[model samples]
Target: MPDKDAGTPRVFLIRHGETEWTKSGQYTGRSDIPLTENGEKQVISSARLVVGPGKIINPSKITQLFISPRKRALRTYELLFDEAARHKFEGKVEITEDIREWDYGLYEGILPSEAKAGRKERGLDKGRPWNIWIDGCEEGESPKDIAGRLDRVIAKIREIQGPYMHGEKPVDVVIVAHGQILRAFARRWLGFEIGVKLPMMLEPGAVGVLSYEHHNVDEPAFLLGVNMAESEE
Candidate 1:
């Protein structure tokens, strides 16, 4: 019998592991923080659970990898794949700013409550609270700015997967990036407006899958859950 899962491609969206700012609930855009010790442990454990042959993220099948420019995200990528696994994607990896975290601007290194208070004190968002999705940050990127860049990334992914969708070859793509940007990418993957609040969240050192339904690239959908493979002894 023919393989039922042929042709359809999968995109693995991975959020980088924790930093001190992430632990403290601070906005960590463009700060280039390194992962905490616990953060490295988290990604190492996650790699063992989700990556390998016959696993959710099989390295041999991956065709492309887009990584954020931040050090924390780069560290997560290093921990997720060993030297042997890295050789599998020799010419396919890209370190792009397009996948970097949202530019939090003046809100960088501050908590949400602090950001809100600052905005209020500045005579901004007078009646309502500050929502990053809608209001954005001072001297930072707006929803439109984010959408423009992410849309380009999405287009590139689609272009890469288009020719392989009906073939027997695997066109799995991987993205290693920050939490907020990955969430936004998911929203845009399904043609959602960035300004609209979506109840989506990605914790540090976690992975989410995006794929099409019925082997049709036009039908983009999220894999809400998947059973993980047991770790090797």
Candidate 2:
């Protein structure tokens, strides 16, 4: 429904279901965190929402499935078909690291409280901003670095779109991935400023359908929908 006739692929970007770290608000990056029980339930419901009632995705229309090689994302993709309630997505699937989760350095497994406490304990919170993206404290990644990586991913997506976004066919692309990285990909692909204070909201087990329309000046990428999780219903 989101402009597949214009050679623009209707990309369905879904973040994997929740993990223990996700529930605890920890910075889950690169670490392999399995889906929680509720998270698996979310996948089943979310898949039904996407493939059935929502009617957002057409299986035949889907040309390819791109995924991050991470465990969580891989499991999410597997659940899409194996889950009893979500049999509609039995389509071809492929994995792509270009869509992998962002690699957070020293801050990878640290819980939010520990981070804040450590900051105060060191007496550095006064001068530096507390937020990770804005501050980029210590060995962690700065927004600038993330924005740059996102740009590379965006460039790859654009390349796949072909002929500078002038391809003439309807295509659907499904990307199974993690939260923060997928959000960054969507933001960068839409030409949003990198590392802005306001970030796109892409919850676990959430699906974001993006419509890319080629215009004379630039290809306008609009969000057909964002953060469509089972929790919403």
Candidate 3:
């Protein structure tokens, strides 16, 4: 007999591997840059460690995948799972704009320091330094805009996971995207407002996990630490 709690579904959030802009601390949004050679290597190594049968992210259990349309993110997904592994969820992959990086607009391709200086020169931040969470980009999507789209994605995830929460099967969803957006997605997954300062970070090639507490869909929470399954012989 299967453990009744085993059916609780989970969402795996993955940030794409490093790019030149990422390595240089630039705000890369909508730039469509490909991953660096090291970035490809990073994803491949990560797959070996965390993705496979019995691993933290068992590819066989993943029923759906939400990916950003950016090439870097697309490439990360390509490297994260090989052809045979991806075949396990052939038609479950969705490439969507909703998961793309937060649009930096005038600040795109610039470093955070440069953005802050620009905002200060423009007399925008007035009393405080420019924080994307609160002040958002001048011509880009605001916190409200981000919440709107992420909310849609979160709704779809809940709808899919609801039916199998108490069943005997496993249902895991995967998301591949950029840093800021994935972090924001996790924040929204727990019903938090993104307009306030949240000291969260997801590095390039990193992964985070979110799931319901005690198999209750109404009680979403982050899995801070999970023991990795031993590699199969």
By TM-score, the better pick of 1 and 2 is: 1
Stretches of candidate 3 exceeding 4 Å from the true structure? 1-6, 230-233
**lDDT value, residue 122 of candidate 2:** 79
Residue lDDT tens for model 1, 1-233? 86454457889999999899989999999898999999999999999989997787888778899999899998999999988989878899999999999999999999999988888888898777777887777999898889999999999999888777765677889999999999989999999998777888888999999988777778888977665752122
Counting clashing residue pairs in each candidate, in order, gives: 0, 0, 0
lDDT tens digits by residue: candidate 3, 1-233:
74444557889999999999999999999899999999988888888899988788888778899999999999999999989987777899999999999999999999999988888788787777677887678899899999999999999999888878764456789999999998889889999988755788887888898988778889888988766883232
* Candidate 1 Cα outliers beyond 4 Å, as residue runs: 1-7, 227-233
Candidate 3 lowest-lDDT run of ten: 224-233
Worst 10 residues of 1 by lDDT: 224-233
> Over all chains combined, what TM-score does candidate 1 have?
0.94
Q: Candidates' TM-scores?
A: 0.94, 0.77, 0.94
Q: How far does residue 202 in candidate 2 sit from its true spot (Å)?
A: 2.1
Score each candidate by Cα lDDT: 0.87, 0.69, 0.87
Regions more than 4 Å wrong, model 2: 1-8, 52-54, 82-94, 123-125, 162-167, 214-217, 224-233
lDDT, ranked from best to worst: 1, 3, 2
